[model samples]
Target: MQGDVGFAQQILSLNLVPRKRLSSCGNDTSLCDFSEMWYGVILWTAVSSLIFHLPAALLALFTLRRHKVARFMPIAILLMGIIGPLTGGVLTSAAIAGVYKAAGKTMISLEALVFGVGQSFCIFVISFLRILATL
Candidate 1:
């Protein structure tokens, strides 16, 4: 949940369009201005959601065999969960850059996405540590 919060905060803080542009668009009757922004956001949400769950998905598939691998499952999950997002940061940043670049966007910073990805990873590790501690 906390990892999700970091991601949400990161995405929410992004200004898809400058307030000046948004104000002008608001005055216009056409929805194109705001619609474009929502499109970018939706793209980000979709990519992030898929990337974040990748580790879990992989673990589930591997664990289904329930053989020798079962003994190392916990360690594998922990390592993969940690490493997955670390690698994801680069991919996320690149994807975000591509989307914004295509949009000719100047308002939003890709750095925010990078930071958000990092924070999400931190939150993931922290949450996992907390869970492990409780046990």
Candidate 2:
């Protein structure tokens, strides 16, 4: 009877341990899932921006001779196209980093911010130039 009781207690303890462990693991997984979701959103936004910007930038570059105002317009547009995106990208990356850090999340790193800025800047410049070209 004594041995049986001891075995039962051991079994109960083992069961309890696994439950706690499982819960902790589940919480970690939840965090990871949220991080992945946020990252996905960022990626989608960046990709969409790129898709929209490409043709616009090309058009702007190609249409410089179409208008009487475009001779000087291309240079101004080119500068804005480059500078606007650069500034916007920097601002965006800084904002993302600040927000994620404030949220106490570990997934948002400096490297991610750098990557995001590069992607955003490229998209912005392309789109801006494209729109300007049409003008």
Q: Which candidate number has the best lDDT?
A: 1
In angstroms, the error of model 2 at 11 is: 50
lDDT of 1 by residue, 1-135 (tens): 555667655655555533334444333222233344434433444445446656676766576657665655655655654565557544654565556557765323344444445546565677779999999
State model 1's lDDT: 0.51
Q: Looking at model 2, report the run of 10 residues with the lowest lDDT sum.
A: 12-21
Clashes of 1: 0
Per-residue lDDT of 1-135 in model 2, one digit per residue for the tens?
555566534532332111222332234322222334245335434544455455655677687666677656545645554564456654554466456557766442233434554666667677669989999
TM-score of 2: 0.36
Q: Clashing residue pairs, candidate 2?
A: 56-130, 57-130, 60-133
Segments of candidate 1 deviating more than 4 angstroms: 1-46, 65-108
